[model samples]
Target: MNDEINYTNNPLHGLGLQELLTQIVDHYGFEILYAYLNINCFKTNPSIESSVKFLKKTEWAREKVEIFYLYQYKNLPRVSSEQFELPPRKRIIPEGQTPREPAELSFEDAERVREKQAKKAAEHGKSKRYKEREFENLWKR
Candidate 1:
């Protein structure tokens, strides 16, 4: 007997990025997407192709779109009152509903999150260096 992991509870499993974008575009036009996400792809001459290409290349933007889908489109229940949150895989899905698969963020989203963290870390390093320089300058004076 083969044991297969059932992901029926997940709301983002089987859906592809293209389909997700299409559904979103259909439900809410580019204008609304632009207003909501503030992505340039939606703002300036938006098209599925262009948006998909941009999303594929840019991780942060893709994560934003995925987050929007999880919150606005899927309508999943909120986790708790905690300020910090768990990743989607750890969160429990509501029972009795056939959740859309692919709940986990896409590869692009994950990469984007990493890139964002790296950028923040770089900025923090810069700040630290600046502070150290200022301290050294004070000593020199």
Candidate 2:
């Protein structure tokens, strides 16, 4: 008797890439997607066909879109650290966790997120430089 539980509960299961992109684009529009994802394909002369082609050629970008689709479009709860490391499509949804309504997203919110990320990156760069300088001083002493 097979005791293994089927873990194909992921919303991405059996979904095609083009279909996924189409759904998100139809709902969110390219501007919002570009704002949130920062993908050039969405920002420059955006269309479903061209974006799909670019995503197909780019693995990392495709994964980014997949993650966006799950957590943003589907509004699924964040996964655990172990599952978080897996690709969004490969991750399993825990039992009893059904997708909720799509989160309300706006270009303004995306702008805020981008600004916060930029600020954090700047701070991180400063701290790294400070630490390197400190290490060099230790060697000099």
Candidate 3:
């Protein structure tokens, strides 16, 4: 049985960089994008043309924007890690899964997300140090 996943259903499949950027900018604006994405292109002198040009030249940033477009703007369900390895344009949406309404986002919500991420990172760092100290103590005994 053939198990090929059809990617044509993805909204990003044939969408141009300019068009994608324009849609998000129209809905969310550059300020909200910068707050959530932290991309300099969106933050500094942001414009649809400038952002599209920058994203065209930059692979990582383009991928980031595409991902934000899929997960946040299109409100698609999160993909499995294997599927996520593919670009958002190529990732396969499971059968019966369709895009939903764009998420309601705000600058304040972005700030809260950043704070939560920072807290998680600090906790991870503390645990790593504790583990290292424990390892050293085990060797010294």
lDDT of 1 by residue, 1-141 (tens): 111233444555566778889988887678766755668999898999999999989876776676566655675545343311433333345566443433333345435544554566566675643432322222121
Q: In model 2, which regions exceed 4 Å deviation?
A: 1-7, 125-141
- lDDT of candidate 3 at residue 7, scale 0 to 100: 62
Cα RMSD to native, each candidate?
A: 13.4, 9.9, 10.0
- When sorted by TM-score, best at the front, the candidate numbers are 2, 3, 1
The order by descending lDDT is 2, 3, 1
Tens digit of lDDT per residue, candidate 3, span 44-83?
9999999999999988778778877887888887676577
Candidate 1 lDDT for residue 35: 57
Q: Which regions of candidate 3 are displaced past 4 Å?
A: 1-5, 122-141
Better of 2 and 3 by lDDT: 2
**lDDT of each candidate versus the true structure:** 0.58, 0.76, 0.75
**Cα deviation of 52 in candidate 2 (Å)?**
0.8
On TM-score, the candidate that comes out on top is: 2
Task: Tell me how far the alpha carbon of residue 40 in candidate 3 is from the true structure, in angstroms, after superposition.
Answer: 1.1
Give the 10-residue window scoring lowest on summed lDDT in candidate 2.
132-141
Tell me the RMSD of model 2 versus the true structure. Answer: 9.9
